[model samples]
Target: MEPKNNLRSLDRQINVFLPAISLICILCIFISCNKQDRTTVIYGKVTDQNHQAVDSILVVAGGLWDFNIEVVKQIYTDENGNYELVIDVPKKYIKLNV
Candidate 1:
């Protein structure tokens, strides 16, 4: 009789935790699905008109919105004349300058 009673108690304990565990798993799934990574990576090697790699060049991206210069991003070229810009794109068009 004692063994049977203990088994029942253990089963009830497991049942109490099962719903909470399942809820936690469902919440995790929703959180991971709702997150979005909204960014763009622009990369290239800068070169002069003579076709030589131009190092230390300054790259700038600008935008106009509502008659104002809304945002500007700047990055410098690497030693190998490589430049990369990770930017958040809010609109369809971007103007880049070197």
Candidate 2:
């Protein structure tokens, strides 16, 4: 009787621990699947045909992903004609519109 009870107790413990372990594993996999794998940094000079700085021109970066399309960010060039945009790396392709 004592050995049978012990087996039952051990089974209960395993049942409880097994679900917890499975839950942890599922959570880990979910997090990994949702994780962003890369990032993007863009730098360019806004210039006119005459090679002059075009200040205040709006530059936008659009990101394309499997799930959705999003505007990553928008930036404006400084007086020096330099612009920068930092965003999560797109899953497939990224389009830069100036």
Candidate 3:
């Protein structure tokens, strides 16, 4: 019957399109997951209230969540009051902490 033929055609069409749609969705997820963030380091100089270098100061870097700042790295300032904190940021946390 015509109705049976139409049903089979519809089923075939769905079977073909479903895989394509699924592939597209998987590709999108992979593309989004491949976010780039590696060369991101927090660096700054510690200065005192009197505009003087604060050597040996503890510099702390953190990844801020909704209501918490998880400590990522910490370093001490050098003789020049300069510090560098290395960290790896993920995509779930917006690639890096603000």
* Residue-wise C-alpha lDDT for candidate 2, range 1-98, written one tens digit per residue: 99999999999999999999999999999999988667768899989999999999988877656655667789889999899887776556555333
Which of candidates 1 and 3 is the stronger one according to TM-score?
Answer: 3
Please name the candidate that would achieve the greatest lDDT relative to the true structure: 2
What tens-digit string does per-residue lDDT give for candidate 1 at 1-98?
Answer: 99999999999999999999999999999999867564767789998898888889988766655555544578989878899888875654344332
Candidate with top TM-score is 3
Q: Who is ahead in TM-score, 1 or 2?
A: 2
Superposition error at 54 for model 3 (Å): 1.2
Could you tell me the lDDT of residue 57 within candidate 3? 83
Worst 10 residues of 1 by lDDT: 89-98
Could you report the Cα RMSD, in angstroms, for every candidate shown? 7.1, 4.8, 4.7
Clashing pairs in 3: none
lDDT of 1 at 85: 88
Q: What is the lDDT of candidate 1?
A: 0.77
TM-score ranking, high to low: 3, 2, 1
Per-residue lDDT tens digits for candidate 3, residues 4-98, read 99999999999999999999999999988886665568888889899898898887766656666777677899998988877776434432442
Give the Cα RMSD of candidate 2.
Answer: 4.8
Q: Candidates' TM-scores? A: 0.49, 0.52, 0.61
